[model samples]
Target chain A: MNPLLSSIFSTGFAFAILRVMTPLLFPALGVAVSELAGSVNIALEGIMLISAFFGVIVSAFTGSLFLALIAGLAAGILMGALLAYFHLKMKADIILGAIALNMFAAGMTIFLLFLFTGDKGSTSSLQSLVFPEIDIPLLKSIPVIGEIFSGHNVLTYVSLLAVPFFYVLMFKTPLGLRIRAVGQNPHAAESVGINVDRIKLYALMLSGMFGAFGGLYLSMGYVSWFSRDMTAGRGFIAIAAATLGGNMPVGILLSSLLFGFVNSIAIYIASLNVPSELIQMIPYLVTLIALAVFAIRAQRKRDKVGEVLEHFDPEAVKAVVKDVIETEGDI
Target chain B: MEKFILKYFTLIRTLIAILVGIIISVVLIYIISDMPAYSVRQFLLGPLLSRGRFANVIENASPMIFCGVAIAIAFQAKQFNIGAEGALFLSAAVGTAFAVSTGMPTVLHIILVLLVAGATGAIWGFIPGILKAKWGASELVASLMMNYIAYFGGLYIINSHFRDKDAGFLVSLRLPETAWLPQFMPGTRLHLGIFLAFIFAFLGYYFLYHTTSGYEIRTTGNNQKFARFSGINVVKVVILAQVLSGMIAGIGGMTEIMGIHRRFNWQMSPGYGWDGVIVAIIGRNHPILIIFAAFFLSYLRVGGQILNLMADVPSELVLVIQSVIIILITAEAFLSTWKNKITIKEAERVEVANESVAQ
Candidate 1:
């Protein structure tokens, strides 16, 4: 197994990790925006599912991959706005709204599959355009890093490029400030006439655009065709990445890479005659472990902060308790 | 009776939203697919044309009753135990394994499966509850993330351990006859689970609204600090709510498997855990109301399937309609003009009071 592992790295397993991570990286970036905006997009699964469906269908119909990408983006925008409308203006619970959208996407896509191709579960027969790999001849000639980075879809490059760009947009811009402000304290932002709702809406729309791009990568870029449940929890993994990264762009990138690495190894191990089902479960198992660990760490920090506050201002705690009781009577 | 009418106003709003949402969904379908014979009315009435389809609706709603009441219990305690999905799957897999492998009398077999399923689900739910209570983990994230772990982990077990060699599909071996639940409607698929659903609905109502423990759970949900001050262990209450919710969801899995499928199929549920969320909302977290909410949703699902079979329309339109209904119902401003009148009355009172005080 150790020899196999060493040979596996030499045999391009590391590069495979990057290629696998590319799909996850894009949506994780989108998830970062949504979570940072304080509206967790649980519909990422559905968005990616529908986008992958439409991306391949539209491309197959129009015979143009670019058009398919546009259609994918449009679908993502629609889902994002739908979720945002429900969560932001409608005051619907975020997770509930997301679950509805996800369910809708799942069932609708299957229904549409039956309507369009007369297939119950997949759309593999469509004449869709597959993305062309980028030819960085010089980069390809270079050593390990070049092998890892070169020869991918244009969308993959864009997803990678988004990491730094998103960092700048999230931290360095006025719009970013407004979004963070809304997430942290919408009341304060509203007091300052920040149009907090509008900021959240915009953030959600942008998140949709990125999520759709991730979907496009899955359909036209990776598989060249769409299958039912094609995204297969990649959207959820993106969400896990975003949260694990603490909703930071760079952190999301790193988290996506970690997930990608685990997924690639799982695939490799499954292919090597290890039980495929157990191997397939590895990524999800690892995600649960990672989430539990992260939750514990965060909980510890919160408890420590509470302890410090209690020691510093015992009277404030009593005041809070009194205020809570008063509020209780009103409810 | 007048108070009843007032209490039922929200129910009326729900009906109107359903109508509007169906209308919009039909319009979207007609525009996209160019079919007019397949209208919203067909979607509303298609399933009721036959007894078999009617039974299907009840069979579907049976699980909704369990999970919906489970969610209602958690909502009472203000614990969002979204892990019901995970709990349901774990129970189904474990219960099926036990049923298929065990050799026992019919009655004992059934009881054992239900008990084991409930306890397993409770353990699954308890993890997140304790995590939230002891470590302050966000129950929402913990529960939701745990769903995937449960799903994939269950898949691993199914593929390796429970794979039925003689069974044609990727499903478990059929349970013994002793483990099977008795059907209620003989020819129809409806089983004794419907009776269980009724019992659960009443039990949930009594447990949440009548019992002292129920009051504590609700009080904790309403105000944690206040509940703590009132000598209630808020943490214990939240954890108990999760356990109760999980047990109810576990029974749902047991009923679904033993009564309907007879085999453990992983994709048996089309996201019923999430649908339970909508039912809880429309029910206003009331147990009695859950029966109606679950029935309404199940009707839409069964009716939509019939409509799709009879007409050229896609069954997915029903889902779009359901999402719209949820959105419309949850919106603050979607209430009728009666709400506007109440707001205006409050405003006028404030204005007149100010005027009198000024003098």
Candidate 2:
């Protein structure tokens, strides 16, 4: 077998995919939540940045992992609330407000980083704690599966659990139902006495929490520092994943896994003769193609339905309507 | 008085927003800096202190002016295509490739290079535009994804094909003198691109306000279903707006390369594209006002740079101010009460005038 093929088939490669998928999974789920609430959070990138920065800073200073997590989550939720306030209360355009928040996050993080560590690029000088890895005893006894899944970062397990958590939260609960109702039709939700604004606010805050975990994983688990613009378009890529997945939990998980597989392959191939830049382009190009294909298929379906309606006979429809009316009168 | 207030309502609102942004930044500097007064002075007065610095403001504003106009046109059509960042980077690389390899007369060389750049950018914009117009895909997501692709794609081309091995860095060969944009000022980097930027702004204004196609674009943006009912081909308008916007952005990229850098060496997106979005928002997506907005932003940028050099303050502070201004300006309820009062006064005055005439 070719060396590249052998390397790809190894258990290590599967582990690599899982490791890479963690960040994308978290943000994609976040995107799904807000998208289902009809308030798509375009500021996921900024939220992630703020959380990543706060996580690193708080951990470095307090030496408490729990404090870091709380600070990071709080920062992310605050940003989500700020976006909601601007969009819902101030009547600002959600997209523009999100864009503003992104810029604010990018700038604020760098400014504070410089102020604290005297370095603008990253927090490499500070020593931040990471979430511990856990090994499942039963899983550890398995063969190739053990190598792929036994010992992994706690966040990785959390991300896997989040898929089901997302499903139950979005499908089973009343809040989830209200969120979906608000997303599908705000006026209808309002007419039913569902606090549309409050539900959306909760949805966005939930999104923030998920995005914060993704950011924390990046800084603490993936690497031990926060870097400038280090989310590196993952937040944007999560949007594509959510859209490609139809904004469903299971679908988002699958798409994120696909992106992760591609990302891992890109990393694997970087050692070959191919230029790294071209390799870097592959995932984004794949996303664009996926979006286009999904959209085209949807369009074709709509066109086929339209064609069916266009060919319907007026006399047949009128005859059916008269028969239904006559049957009702007889009853 | 009511008529005057109504006429200048937007201007008043925008001014207040800008003032609020400045005040917020001032408060931030005061809290952050030990030498608050000096830092504030440097931020406010540094851009006007010297001719070179003032010229830097103009030079910086030039590319942004083109981008602002491009964004204004696209946004007028209600297309949220933010691929200008990618389009500019990729087109600049292509333009540089042409500038380095081709041999031609100076004037013709510059024109041809610019045209090629514009065409390249149009292709970038067309992808998202067609996707959204034909398939109902989100232009926002498609365009955002395209930016990353454009960045890496441009980087690949430059690194593999155009890499000047002797330069010890990722950069192309020096552009030919014929392709260079001529300098306008003796002691500064100000170039002929500034004039082109101004020309493009005026042309954008004319195209948007004076042409039938412009009307179609605006109508489609204002109300898509209504435009369709009125016999407008909205799909065509949507795609046209994106392509035209991309072309302008492409030309802006070429000018930045030709006018300042003179090489294809940008390691990252230059961020002028995002600045253009800020400018467009500040100008309310109007072409003529974009020029002023571009200048205002560039002035702040120059001031930030000066403050950074003199007071150890990071220039990212300006970004904070810019975002604040954007959010405030776009907030519909920011000063709604004042606007409502002015409208009520106008209505009352009109009724009084009618009664007097009847008497």
Candidate 3:
């Protein structure tokens, strides 16, 4: 077997995919939440930057990981509240407001970075703490599964746990129902005494929380330093992930895993004779193709529904319409 | 006077937003800078103090004008196709291949390079446009993904085929003299691209406001369902808007390369496409207004550079100010009460005038 092929086939490669997918999963989950609320938080990019920056700064100065985590989460939630004020209260365009926040985060982080550390690129000089890795003793006893799942960073396990947590939160809770109702129809939600603005605010804040975790993982677990624009395009790619997943918990997990697999492959192939730039293009190109396929399928589904409607029996349609009007009148 | 104020309410609100943005920057400087007063002075006065510095403003604003108009055009048609960044990068690389390898008459060479650049950009725009039009894929995400693909793809082409090994950097061979845009001033890099930028802006204004297709684009943008009901082809209009936007962005890239760099050497996305968004927002998505917005943004950028060099302040401060202005100006309710008051006053005056005429 070829060396490259052998390397790819190992349990280590599966572990690499899981490791790479953690950050993406967090933000993609965030995107799904906010997108479900009908106010997409494109500023996950900025929120992640702020959280990552504050986490490093607080941890480095105070020497307390807990304090750093609090500070990071607080910063992200505050950004979400600011966006809510701008969009819901001030009637600003959500997209433009989010774009502004992204620019602010990109600028203010670098500006404060220089002010604190005298470095414009990264905080490599600071001795930031990394989150500890956990080994599942029972899982470690297994052969292939143990190698792939044991001794991973604590956040990676948390990310996996988050999927089920997200499913419960989105499906089983009253707040979740209200959020979905608000997303489906704001006027109807409002009429039922569900404060649309409040629900949206909650949704955005929840998104910020999830995005903050991703940022913390990037700065603390993935590497031991805070870097300028370190999120790169992962924040944007998460939007693609969320959309490709149809904004569902299980779907988001699968899509994020897919992206992680492609990204890890891109990383592995860099050692080959192929130009690294072309290899770098693969993940993004895959996203474009995936998006197109998703859109086409969705379109076909809609057309099929239209076809069904067109072919409906007139007598059955009339009976259903009359039944709905009678039921409304009785109400 | 009340009527005048009411008519220009949006303009007034925008001016106020800009003022607030400047004040925010000043406060930030005072808090952050050791020598606050000096930093503020350099930021406000540095660009206007020197002839050469002012030229930098013009040189910077030229490409911004092109991009601003491009953004304004696409935005007018309500297509959030941010692929201008990708189109600019990819087209510049393709244009450079022509600029470096081909030997032709100066005028013909320039035209050929620009046309190829525009066509390349159009293709970039067409992808997202058609996707959104046909299948409802979000143009915003599609275009953004395209930017990275273009960046890496362009880099691959440049690194593998066009890399000048002796240049000591990852750059293409120097552009030939035939390709350079004519410079207006001997000392300044201010080139004919500035005039071309102005021409393009005017043409964009004409195409968007005067032509039948422009009407269709605007009508579709204003209300897609209504436009469709009125017999307009919303799909075609959307695709056309993206393609035209990409073409304009492509030409802008060509101008930047032809006007400034001696060789094709952009290691990272230069971010002019993003700046064009700010320009379009500030200009309120109007072609003519975008020129002034470009000049204003370029002035601030130049000032930031000077402040960085002289006062030791990071120029990223300008980005903070730009974002604040964008958020405030786009907020519909920001100055709504004041606008309403002005409109009420104008209505009262009109009623009084009518009563007096009847008497």
Best by lDDT: 2
| Isolated chain A TM-score, each model | 0.85, 0.88, 0.89
User: Which pairs of residues collide in model 1?
Assistant: none
Tens digits of per-residue lDDT, candidate 3, B26-129, equal 99899788999999999999999999999999999988888888888888888887889999999999888878899889999899989988999999999999
True contacts kept of 1: 0.47
Q: DockQ winner among the candidates?
A: 3
Question: For model 2, what is the alpha-carbon lDDT of residue A269?
Answer: 76
Looking at candidate 2 chain A, the ten consecutive residues that score lowest on lDDT are A322-331
Q: Show where candidate 2 strays beyond 4 Å.
A: A1-10, A115-119, A125-127, A191-193, A307-331, B352-359
Interface RMSD of 3: 1.5
Q: What share of the true interface contacts does each candidate keep?
A: 0.47, 0.78, 0.86
TM-score of each: 0.86, 0.93, 0.93
Where in model 3 is the C-alpha error above 4 Å?
A10-13, A125-127, A141-144, A191-193, A307-331, B353-359
Report the C-alpha lDDT of model 2 over A1-331, residue by residue, as the tens digit: 9777898999999999999999999999999999889999999999999999999999999999999999999998888889899999999888889889998988899899988998879999998899898999999989999999988899999999999999999989998999888987899899989999999999999999999999999998988899999998788889978887878888899989988988898877778767878767776787789889977866775565455557797775555446544642210
lDDT of 3 by residue, A155-229 (tens): 899999999998899879998888888887889999999999999999999999999999999999988899999
Displacement of the residue A62 alpha carbon in candidate 2, Å: 3.4
TM-score of chain B alone in model 3: 0.97
Ranking of all candidate structures by their lDDT, best first: 2, 3, 1
lDDT of 1 by residue, B196-234 (tens): 888988999999889998999999999999999999988
